[model samples]
Target: MDLPSDTPAASRTPRPARVAVVTGSDSGIGRATAVRLASQGMDIGITWHTDEEGAHRTAEEVRAHGRRAALARTDLSRLPDAAGVVEDLARELGRIDVLVNNAGTGTATPFVDMEYETVREVIDVDLIGPFLCGQVAARRMIRQGDGGCIVNVTSVHEHQPRVGAAPYCAAKGGLGLLTQVMALELAEHGIRVNAVAPGEIATPMTGQEDEDVRRTSRPGVPLGRPGDAREVAAVIAFLASEESSYVTGASWAVDGGMLRMGPQAGSHLESDAWRRP
Candidate 1:
């Protein structure tokens, strides 16, 4: 982490307005995170794989907050140059201070029935993509000689598995460990890394597309409903902010207590008359 000779002392000051690159920010949790980081006064770099229009909409929200916004198209699964978008955004925004690796895809096919290509695709998107993006961001941060942050948007599956989502579960679990390793390596350079694992968020990914979480109901979730994308974004924003300066290599759960229901669920069942094996 060598500083340039001309770097100003003030540039090293705490809490300076910074820049962030958020991948797959066209909609859902990515969109909410871009907007929330904007509201916090950071210029944003937005990317999309398929939703160009939604990316523009997210940029509009960022500009509405009076911060600069840059947009690009990134397919993390195909990394011709994993850092290309980060370089472009850094050139446009002048520096990269935060990187949120939020772009990912999943499949619900059972492990036995899953196609090899589908499993590869999920791993490429969920694990490999973030790994490359984080590496690029870290290199940039090290070159800039200033601390930075990286937040990987994992899922409850990072800690627990689902019935038919073997690839998704494996990739997320891999990413959770990757986050810790990145944190360990980058801490010496003042770079922080962490993860946010959300459960049943009301987003397009969960088939809730734009639905309000407050209006939704879920009996299985201890909190009584799915979470909002914004709710998850709030935790991400914290991890990206100076407020979490001391936090690194940690995975914060924003799952509305859904992760706690597994054991309690069986115990709470009313038809438990037989203990015979």
Candidate 2:
């Protein structure tokens, strides 16, 4: 069992721990994702736009799981450069193996009443931010000469429209397509790109922080309850892990059958006149 004298010393050394950058991880699904990945042994880079306290708490949780966690402040709405946070995190964590574009914002104003700035902000946070972050992470992965994973935390709105979520829906829809394109282009470099579309999760975004989804009732959801951030994080972890090595360019719906109700509910309506008359 003696090693050959010609064997390089570097080959005898263990590979560095994998690192993951989870943006908007100050709370909710992002926080859950950071912790989940950490549980899977990834050193985490946690980012927050406005929730510094929450980000620190998430970092603590990641560390509690015996993983290193780096913290950063990132505002995706700043665009074109917001992605620099990824590089910053990579620098702090030594290397980047995964990038989770989980940061986003939205407005409920009607389309006609929506201010230009509001729409622009939504697009900048949801679409442009992921685009830039993906680009930066991909380039770093390519340079490192190792495969990587990018998971974009899209929403159920990506495929289905909500009454007051014009900007949110549009931005998520765009990110879905962008995920596919990134997968196609980065496949050559062994980078896997995918999107996770979450339904009504019991997160701060839904005004249900720390609430147990099992106790809450969601009549619209087929499961009769909202999802948990951890539930969505589990899927994200899968996508970010070697378990999904063959999976890319796909949008996995972590919804509780919420997306399936749309067509069924519409078809059950007694009036066909609204369809096309």
Candidate 3:
């Protein structure tokens, strides 16, 4: 029996792709994660809900790091939108070696006055969206017979409740537990699941520079400053790398000491230099 003289050498197996799909990657933490992963040698797949220009900027940075960047528009509140994102990423970049469920929604409204729709939407985006993407990514990774990592971009709200973010708190809390549950279930298959809970990081979503959110936010953090997106991305990069191979089912906080900051932070740090005049 003879075969064709040449069949493109079986497509070269695509260099054994290592790619990450980071949701809400157009700005802030998501964008930072995409860039970091690229720097660390993983092709990046980014999704943006509203920040198309920012997403493109991130893609350019990811590309600059010498890795393929697949960018898309995603609205996690829509179930179909959430589920399809991972599939699209895998199709575009060969295979998904890492999945970062980073997109989310938050509101500063009191729980009692909150409409049911508001809470539902947050839960859908922050919690359900991650679950769907994880399920899809795990299936693909398993079929490829190569284990991978799934990092959920949760919030400090997962462990410490915020005053007015009822829905955000609820969704992140669920994500915390869900991360552990998936870790337990997927360990047998060699897949790892973990979470990154960030505190008051400066991001487009928070619009912390918008004067209002900024003034009200300073008093809440012990570091006396909001975190930068790059710091959070560094942690995510560690979680996705082979260096952290022994780590899984863990929730790491990148929140400039915010979660541990108690109500007494005001007593420790004095602002006698400037008054709210």
Ranking of models by TM-score: 2, 1, 3
After superposition, candidate 3 runs with Cα above 4 Å error: 1-15, 209-220, 263-277
- CA shift of 275, model 1, Å: 22
Which candidate gets the maximum lDDT versus the true structure? 2
Error of 3 at 123 (Å): 0.6
The TM-scores of all predictions, comma-separated, are: 0.90, 0.92, 0.86
lDDT tens digits, residue span 73-171, model 3: 878778856679899989999899999999888988876789999988899999999999999999998997868999998998899777778889999
lDDT of all predictions: 0.89, 0.90, 0.86
What is the total number of backbone clashes in candidate 1? 0
Query: What digit string (tens of lDDT, one per residue) describes model 2 on residues 159-275?
Result: 988766788999999999999999999999999999999998888888998997899987767999999999999999999988888899999999999899978867666865443
Estimate the overall C-alpha local distance difference test score of candidate 3: 0.86
RMSD value for candidate 3: 7.2
Which RMSD values do the candidates have, in order? 4.9, 4.5, 7.2
Query: What does the lDDT read for residue 193 in candidate 3?
Result: 94
- Regions more than 4 Å wrong, model 2: 1-13, 267-277
Q: What lDDT does model 1 reach?
A: 0.89
